[model samples]
Target: MALDETTRQVNKRAVAALEAAVWGLREADVSVIKAVQPLEDLSNVTNAHDPALEELNALTVRIRAAREEVRRRWIAESEGER
Candidate 1:
């Protein structure tokens, strides 16, 4: 059966959130690599705080939450249709 407009919209939002999460992870990975590259030659390394990393982490969390919300809504709607 074809999905109704609301369901289609939910699915699209879910997909977009998933894509954003993936992209965020990739960006985070790159940031981490860049941050560590300078210390690669050093024997002793200390943890350093980075604002970019923090922001990316927050963004990833939000994206996952959005995805979960979409899934929950879709499941609830499907169940209601039965």
Candidate 2:
């Protein structure tokens, strides 16, 4: 998609934040992980400058969503068993 200038900027920022979060995770930077916690849907992050599509972008989003759902289900099941 042809993004407008503002969208391009936003996308750049999102991608940067996502990359920083990943690197922080690899480096075990707790602060960076906490900072990016709210931005769980990583697919919303884009990097047009990247030479190819990034699997990490989509994977993060999917993983975050699934994690949340799984957590909720686990909690509910545990509560039911109580």
Model 1 agreement with the true structure over 1-82: per-residue lDDT tens digits: 3568777777677667656665665666566566545544332344354444555556657656665665665565545542
For every model shown, what is its TM-score relative to the native structure? 0.46, 0.36
lDDT of each: 0.58, 0.49
Residue 9 deviation, candidate 1, in Å?
Answer: 0.7
- Candidate 2: RMSD to truth: 21.2
* lDDT at position 2, candidate 1: 52
Best by lDDT: 1
Model 2, 1-82: lDDT tens digits are: 5567776676566556555554544444344354455354442575452322243445556656655555554454434431
Q: What is the lDDT of residue 73 in candidate 1?
A: 56
Instruction: In model 2, state the lDDT of residue 31.
Output: 43
